[model samples]
Target: RGSLDLNLETLSGNLIAQNHSFHVLEKISFELPRVELCPEVLKRAKSFVLADPIFGKPGPIDVLIGNSLFPQLLTNERHSLGANMPSALGTIFGYVIAGTAPCLSTAPRASNLAISLLSTTDTDLHSSLQRFWVQEELPVYDKKSEGELACDKLFETSHTRDSQGRYVVRLPFVDNLAYAKLGTSRPIAAHRFESVERRIHARNSSPLKALYIDFMDEYEALGHMKKPPHLNLSAPHYFLPHHGVVKEHSSTTKLRVVFDASSKTSSGLSLNDVLLTGPKLQNNICDILLHFRLKNLVFSCDIRQMYRQIKIHPDDQRFQLILWRGQPSLPLSTYQLTTVTYGMNCSPYLAIKTLQQLAQDEGSNFPQAAHILKHHSYVDDLIAGASTEAEALELQQQLIELLRLGGFELRKWVSNCPKLLQQLPASHQEPPVFLQPSSDPMFSILGIHWSPVTDCFKYNLNFTSDAPTKRKVLSLIARIYDPCGFLS
Candidate 1:
């Protein structure tokens, strides 16, 4: 029928009528399958007529209702069909059996199914707001696990300062016997080194190869990596496989050699597997950003090679060995990483713990800087400020001096006040162009972009013209990166 008013009766003897006239399909050419209801379900739903009049026998479809009429047909009441069986739903037209049922005959038959769509914008918005609140809120203190407590105990008991003022710490092993489980790793390390060399040589230009060599050479020159005096292949040692990573956007080193401590030894155990990953010691990013916004003269700086600043104990250096050769013609040599390597599980904890220890030891000389280091730093990046320009300058000086006491150098300094930055050495500050007011310089604070000239945050949204699917929509939403909820 083109348009009609329909009335339906329920098993409860309630009469329901359509709110308004609605159009319906007059004839459906296809045959609908017969749905056999369970005898027990029918007994429980006594005197209730099936939603479909000819539910138990195959028949040609007479009328079809669209999704717009679902609200009038459906109800919240439901009757379960028991385990592993379809359930019957309470609708205005009586009880409707839903879900899969066995086929009555060997021949295939079509089944009658209704699909309904509802708008979920309100539900999605509510969920999004909840996630935003949880992420932007301050982090709560969590109790340390047994492994973390053990790591802390090891650091407190064995850490010491060298003549150069660098903090030397031992690796936090699971137990005293953890190192004994390690097997020979030199063969695997050699294979991985060959693979890396082949990849670099296959590049179109030789610059990549040269860059890789230069990076390893610098690592050696800085005293971070050294050739072991004695070769003891029988000793319990772990060798890390290394590869090069290129970042063209970086202003300093373009190629960085990354050591893979997760590489397993012959005994099927990795260095990371035996070491205890210490508890997270850095302040949360939300807290750091909140304090950054509280001051009039804000600035940002980060430790240069932060992990390499802390020295590892000599006894643990054998576990951080690597294979390197400047060229294919040169003989391969074994080198031990003396500093806290980045790929190890305990590196972050050791570096951060060292910083806190330094602050506690010398905080009395520079209280403001000490507080900032302890509370305003997120990992290696420092985001702090003061109420005035003079206060900011003094804080900056104190921070530089205090960090120097532990042999930690800060670089990439940027600020809203030009005069404060002017006091810093040209080599120590970020590019001079970032301070020019005519050219608004935007740098990343964590992942969000901020413009020093305008003193405001910026967002670059790159949306695609592709059709909006569930996955694509979610991906686009994730790229927003507004941790501070500035858009809200």
Candidate 2:
């Protein structure tokens, strides 16, 4: 059966010879339920038979045997019987029906040889009789009627977000042997570690950008003021509330509101009202520039929920928000912010002022701290830069105090500036040293592991291994067959 010919001509001859034997029985036992035969399949097969009454008759011998005997009944009600039917029966049945019992009596060829041997019981007859059989009869390979191929489906479990705020599709597993050709199998299974590493390494020319930050477009037509205010805030000056949009020098580049500003009335200089003026920005930027130029490194850290730690100004607590039909609404005084919101204009400035005050106080104990960080700077967006590791550490210690005083907690999985990392000779690049905790959970920006003790950062290296990376494996399967590729 392994090498048995499956051609239309060969199958036709066998049917003619078997036709006589088929009529010998009045009603053959099918061993299968009659309902298992699908009307649609039968109708399709019926097209191949001759219109002649004698040729059209499906007699006892014509009854298909084996598992496929009931394939037509692959419906839900009769599936049990059909599912167990032997596969070979379906193949043979399909062949007979497709060949339509060709009239070999007029022109007999290898088909005649096949027909002549159908009734014989000789074991070697198959090989000898097959010598006249045409070996290259084209097969239709019509799987359309066979139904969709059974392949394991990979589903996206969560709404994964990309940098653009679009839901990203994820394929956690690599296409393994299960997806290979019927008999083709591979020795190793794919994982994401290596592929992810290679993708990271390929972008070595530039520093990685923060995943949480993005360039915002401010130039799009501003929404009509008539709709409804999404946020409620109390303000003396027109402080853009957090999450609000503001225009920069250019219409194309709009700066999103990260903080809010307010004036303190009848107050002696409290840190809250010290508007982060142009002088302050210049001072902070200057320190940042100095460290970056000298040390060839600069990094910023964010306090986890920095504003949430600050008590709302007693006079300003009235402004809060209410969610109505999924939209924020209501009076300004009632909307209490649950956490530090990033779009407020004053939050960043206030946060910076607080940090500076805290650093000044902490530096008093260790006078060298202020000197070491003489050029280290920040403006709510905490940047630490230094020519030497010792300088960075001194700054880090001061920043830690600043964080503590401001009541903002530091995340352990945070990252520091790689440019601040101590340069190593080729001889010592493989130790697990730490410089600071990562600010991002995914570590998309750092591109390497940072250790504080050894003060070292190492490039990730899973790209070359057998394991596939999240990004690279995604890219490979993407090239082969991206789901969106079809749609596009």
Candidate 3:
């Protein structure tokens, strides 16, 4: 109704008339009083035709047929119902009642129906251009929420370095509300552990069960988790339910244990529910990729067990307990996670903040490495490069030394330059399968496939033969994974 470019449907069929033009109204506003008619009047008519099936019911009008199009729709025939009732006019489209019908109710009625219309084209070109630019402009990052601000302040004031040089941070809880409201989680944890145990013991799952045991054994051997000294069943503690996630393609670790911190307790509150997710600290992924592409020589690596490398404060370790047993014949033992866990709500923030803090503290000695850490790194992955071979080697050395100061080991090192790969220890370098000459080996750089030999990003898209629906097309598009706009 606001613009002349319109398509409409009616009770009979689609209104297909076209090419007719009329003067556009700058503005129009009106009010229509409610009308009621006796049902008997239509019943007594010789012939009946309804333009709208439920015209008697009060409802909002979708469109108004103005005088400009009324003539085209007329058939020049009419039928009279009665003296008080409206006459039915025949049109090529359908029959429409033209005159008003007498109100059946004797009581007075007031009209609240109002309609307003303004031409969209009335706006000047300058105003329209301004609106277009406003929409096209990049969105400004929103101000941090109160909880985020509090988390930042807490980390800054409380985070400290441990004897092993690893950074230790307290959990960012939403005040003390989470601790006060926490209920017994042992029963839930026990139930979940039993379920996982049953799955591992299922027929033909011997390999999976052994892998799970080895993962948990390595977890304890590395001191990421430890048995509590004293038993306190009544204490406010959480038991994280954990499960194994197997990635057959992984080079170093095939199976990894993922803890579930979001499991609800008896009070219906989970550890994640009470935790505050701190503000994002990582550089924009697009910016990182652009910086990565600028240099001729590029290399990528990730921190080994990045989250587990950072210790959680002793006071907050109680909230990260878990139930584990090597065999189904043994009873479940409670173990506390001493490090920042993978599934915690604030783990990402704590890990990134710790990295930033390391750079800030030691950047004076390693300026180039510090800059790469701040600007070129995304989460735990470092995708950075240099213009020359000498500069690339220097950067690699400095990054390794700087990260070592914080007890963070960078592994899975891959680069386009074979000389650079030779410099890294065999254990630290990525598997030789990625560097094999016979095959076009591909490496995953933050979910995007990258070919080191050609120094080009590659996509592995698998499309289904399903019908091309809106959802299916979007799903296919999402699989492209071209965050750097290489296709654009």
Q: What's the TM-score of each model vs. the native?
A: 0.70, 0.28, 0.69
lDDT per residue as tens, model 3, 166-271:
8989999899666878777887688778878887888888889989999899999999999988757677889999988999988888898889998877665789
lDDT of 3: 0.79
Candidate 2: tens digits of C-alpha lDDT, residues 193-303: 222223323456122211102321111111101112343222321222223244533212233433332211222111232322211221334334334334433344445
**Number of colliding residue pairs in each model:** 0, 45, 0
Off by over 4 Å in 1: 1-140, 203-205, 432-439, 465-474
Q: Write the per-residue lDDT of candidate 1 for residues 310-418, one digit (tens) a residue.
A: 9999989999999999878889888999999977888889999999999998999999999988988988888999899899999999999999999999988888998
Please list the residue runs of candidate 2 whose C-alpha ends up more than 4 Å from where it truly belongs after superposition: 1-287, 296-300, 320-334, 338-345, 366-375, 385-395, 410-488
Span of 10 residues, lowest total lDDT, candidate 3: 24-33
Error of 3 at 339 (Å): 0.5
Off by over 4 Å in 3: 1-140, 432-439, 462-475
Q: Which window of 10 residues has the lowest lDDT sum in candidate 1?
A: 115-124
RMSD of 1: 19.6
Which one wins by lDDT: 1 or 2? 1
* Displacement of the residue 476 alpha carbon in candidate 2, Å: 33
Instruction: Sort the predicted structures by lDDT, highest score first.
Output: 1, 3, 2
